[model samples]
Target: MGTSEFMLAGLVPGIAQTLDVSLARAGYLTAAFAAGMVVGAPLMAALSRTWRRRTALRAFLVLFIAAHIAGGLTTSFAVLLATRVVAAVAYAGFLAVALTAAAGLVPPDRTGRALAVLLGGTTLACVAGIPGGALLDAAFGWRAAFWVVALLCLPAFAAVSRVADTPAGGVTDLRAELRELRHLAGALLLAALVNAATFGVFTYLAPVAAGVAPVPVVLAAFGFGCFAGITAAGRLADRWPGHVVAIGGSLLLTGWIVLALVPGALVFLVFTQGALSFAVGGTLITRILRQATGAPTMAGSYATAALNVGATAGPVLAGAMNPFRVAAALVAVALVSAVAGRSGRPAGPGRPSRSRRR
Candidate 1:
């Protein structure tokens, strides 16, 4: 699913040519999918009360597969955009259900490990799947890459259907989750900002890399950093999560600075862009999930929605900014996390602060 979601990154040039659109307009392909996830995540949670988790998963998985095929076959840009939206709906639903089920599949002591494995699977997708898809897109055409992802989803569907059990997540009160998100205003704002900064660069990496290095090398580096960063985030969250987030945000800011200073220096572009990718895809993703501590049933959907909302906005925002100026958003992310970490510090002798409890 992660692979499918991000495969468009490498294919931007090819897609732009195929659709007769500008590279920036081609970016709307990503935003359209994110738009669907924005709506689909919450809708799935609301619908889950009556739907069996496994059945819903299977259904969504099938829809996702079909949507990819349609995307691959379409020549019309509008059709492709519509197909992406449909695929995203299923993509969001599958994630929401799969994550909810994963937590219940283990004992309380092992829940964190179980959830980490799921997130790791997603990171692994970035490491291999998205980059590999990009390679295929470069070699063949973008549509051919879409077909490859469609085929990959087949085994995933079969494996989950055969091996996974359906765990019924109790009905999540939507109103309550909204209240919790409001209570977590600072965290949610940070999550959106981080996502916005991350996507702003990523969605434009194709054209941006053209001005810097070989497209393949840049994509591979970006994906590798994403995997490593997310892997580190799990370890960080186990100990000093607040500190890690602040540190990640600071690293992200540095990455943007490097990009601004040396956008075309191959070595620096790879290193700093990779680092920026790491912070965005890894720790920031975990940060969004961390904020859902107050709402279990709505946690998966809420986190997904928050990120998607930013994801939807980022590409559009990037479209309007000079790539060099994209760094401005990361500066904001760094400052916000610094403030959050300070607030999370131990407040008194016996009592911990709200962020510390997180």
Candidate 2:
């Protein structure tokens, strides 16, 4: 699903040029996609409670495949935009069901691992699908890239059909889910703030890279660093989940400031941006889940919603900032993360302080 969306990133400049639209209009492609994610997360969660998991998964994939094909066939930008929303709806529904299904399939001890695998698919999608789509767009028309995505889903759909079916859990109790929300204020607020900072800086990553070093070398360095950071986050989360976020956010804060101030260290700048991506995508997801501790279902939905919200907001905030301003914003975010980390410390062996265990 992420790859499918990233595919649009490569296509947007071309699409805008082809359609003779403003960049802002072309930008709506992202908004439309994200809008779907925002609306879809909760809607899918609500819907999943009604359908059997396997049945819902199959239906959502089918719809996603159909939407992709529809998007490829459309010539009217409005129609294409609408089709993208359809694809988003399908994507959101599939994710909600997929995560729920994964949890059901695994032992409680392994839920984190299961979620990590699901998220890893998205990271790998960036590594492979986005670049591949860009190359396809370069060779053929950008429309061909959408067609490629439409074609790829056929096998994905077939494979999804093969997963063994499980019995549905109790009817999704929305009231219970609603009750969980009140207790999650700290986690939710922290997530929103973290995403805003990460997205703000990350949204401007390419420009930040170009400003610091030779663009080509910077890109390669960034990709390599992202791979390393993402690989490390899962293991780190297992031991010091909270600390992992603090460390990751701190790296991002420091890195973005360097990129903004140094102005000619592409390698280091790229390394930092890559770290932000890797940490935000990896540890941040885990952090959101951990915060949702006792409320997996609602947490899953809300986390997904927070991700969409961040993805939506980051670029807009970044776009609004001047270079130095962007760096300052990142530093502010880092500080907030550090403070949140201090307050969120879980009680562990030999760590009780005054007023605890009273």
**C-alpha TM-score for every candidate:** 0.80, 0.84
Write one digit per residue (lDDT tens) for candidate 1, span 1-358.
Answer: 7777777777888999878999989988877877889999878766774566677778888999999999999889999999999899988888877666666566544444455667766656656766777789888888888888888888988877874555454555667766887755565556666677766776677688886678767766766666666566555555556566666666667767766776765445554555545444444445555556556666667667766776777777888875546645655655766586666656787656675565
lDDT of 1 at 46: 63
Clashing pairs in 1: none
Those runs of model 2 whose alpha carbons end farther than 4 Å from true positions after fitting are: 17-20, 128-130, 167-170, 290-296, 323-331, 334-358
**lDDT of candidate model 1 versus the reference:** 0.70
lDDT of 2 by residue, 143-230 (tens): 8887777778888778878877765453547777767777565555555656665456545556776655665465555555666666
Clashes of 1: 0
Best by TM-score: 2
Question: lDDT winner among the candidates?
Answer: 1
- lDDT score at residue 152, model 1, on the 0-100 scale: 85
C-alpha RMSD values across all candidates: 3.9, 3.8
